[model samples]
Target: MRNLKYYFAIFSIFIMISCGENAEKKVEEKSKEETQIETEAKVSEKNVILFFGNSLTAGMGLEASEAFPVLIQNRLDSLNYNYEVVNAGLSGETTASGKNRINWVLNQDVDVFVLELGANDGLRGIPIAETRKNLQDIISTVKEKNPNTKIVLAGMQIPPNMGEEYTTDFRNIFPELAEENNVELIPFLLEGVAGDPELNQQDGIHPTAEGYEIVADNVWSVLEDVVEKE
Candidate 1:
């Protein structure tokens, strides 16, 4: 009877020890999971800046790094701003196509949206009203997706090959949209680089890598205000 009692006591202690170890291990695992979750949350907390446009924004004929959007990203990183820039530019994309893809591009949250379309539309001589409506729909879709997303319209200008009246109407589109939507505007996206032989690539449309530096500056001027305010 004494031996049996001693064995029973020993067995109880072994079970208690096993349960204590299991409990401790579970607690440690839970702590690790919580830490991992917090780390992921921190990573996801970074804001996003989406640049939606055409070949210019896509940096056609230049490396992805030479694109103004990437340059903007590098500048943001240098300033230690926690924003991720998504270069959603597609070569040859017009405002109509942009409107079609805006919803898909906006799958993730966007803090700042830079609209750089309609240049192709102007170049192609698409009707001013159609371009305007497409852009308005795009803007409306963006606002509907997230009302707080700040938008910046990158104004563009084309030569008079499409007629001076058409040119004037296209030029007027950007500021009008900006005023109507109450969004920020970059007066002219190509500013210093446009029509400058040295600044352009062979196509005379897209900027050279060197010219992209100026383009980045043009964007940053207005972008700085928008981001700093945030």
Candidate 2:
């Protein structure tokens, strides 16, 4: 009977060890799952603000960090806002090009979309009707992708050298589109910097770093309200 007791005790000890090992494994798995959840939550918490546009927005002839979108990122950081700014501006990108690739850009979630395209179209004297249609399509696609996304139209105007009537029509496109689409509009992306030679680079087209600061202010004026609404 003593021998029998010893065997039973050994069996009991084995069962207890097996149970302890399983519990430890379960604990490790739970920890790993919790860590994954936390990582995903952090990623989801950051709102994406996409600055989609042309050379001016691309900060041509200047450092990328000096771009208005990067300036906006710095401002957001200073304000402690949970947002990530993506400067998707391509040099010499026209409205047509913007429309063609907008779908790929929309692949990611966008909380705020700042539209700065069409300047090249105006400079190249592309038909206003075509530019308008492209802009409309771009906005429509963005809404279709993420209806909750807020759009901010950055108004741009071509030089009067483009011609009086064409310039007027181009300038009107922004506010008209904003009114129709019910989106926010920045009156002119280069409000305080456009005509000032000091604010412009050698090409007198793109803004200098000092000029982008004012551009940042122009965008921030409208963007702050949209961000605060959330």
Candidate 3:
């Protein structure tokens, strides 16, 4: 009877050891999976980027996929990010028009704002002071809605034909606005593609597909910082 009891004790101890080892293995696997999921989520950019601008932003002359906003979307996708870019661009919209669109244009999911208005204002030769004020109001409204939202101010420069003084004033609007709003600014929205006639479409104002690629590069350079993957 004593011998039999000893054997039973040994068998029970062995079973307990096996059960503990299995439990430990399961816990380790679950931990590893959790870490992988977290890493992947961080690597994929899932933030919403709302682009508000004029004809250039609306892809006025280019196809749907040829627009800068669309190109940005493609680039983000290639990086395995989960994000959405809204082209809230109205052709020929001045700074005032952008102000009116602000309150309603903000979506709940907006994590970043790319302000590209004022180009039409420059074209129309509107007062720079009013343009600055209008842009300021839009940024303020957005900040009020989402204090943490990252902003990219898309700058514009009128042609020298607009008059040197006027062109300089128009160009300065972006930096001044950015300083006041405390946001990132792209030196030029059209950068390399604006004056290049070959890259422009028939209107010579809006960019063609090739031109939009350059525009996308300009925006992406500054926006790449706050832009994160899901």
Candidate 1, which segments miss by more than 4 Å at Cα? Answer: 1-37, 228-230
In model 3, which runs have C-alpha deviations exceeding 4 angstroms? 1-45
| Candidate 1 accuracy as lDDT | 0.90
TM-score (C-alpha) between model 1 and the true structure: 0.85
lDDT tens readout by residue for model 3, 1-230: 21343454455455655676657776566556555655654544356889988888999966788889999999888887677788888888888988987888985558899999988888888888999999999999999999988888999988787799989998999998898878999999888887788999877888889888898999999988878765
Clashes of 2: 0
Tell me, by lDDT, which candidate is best: 1
Error of 2 at 168 (Å): 0.9
Residues 115-146 of candidate 1 have per-residue lDDT tens digits of 99999999899999999999999999999999
Among all candidates shown, the one with the greatest TM-score? 1
Instruction: Arrange candidates, best lDDT first.
Output: 1, 2, 3
TM-score of each: 0.85, 0.84, 0.79
lDDT of 2 by residue, 78-185 (tens): 898889899999998999999999999998889999999988999899999999999999999999999999999999988988789999999999999999999999
- C-alpha RMSD for every candidate: 11.3, 11.3, 12.2
Candidate 3, residue 103: Cα displacement in angstroms equals: 0.7
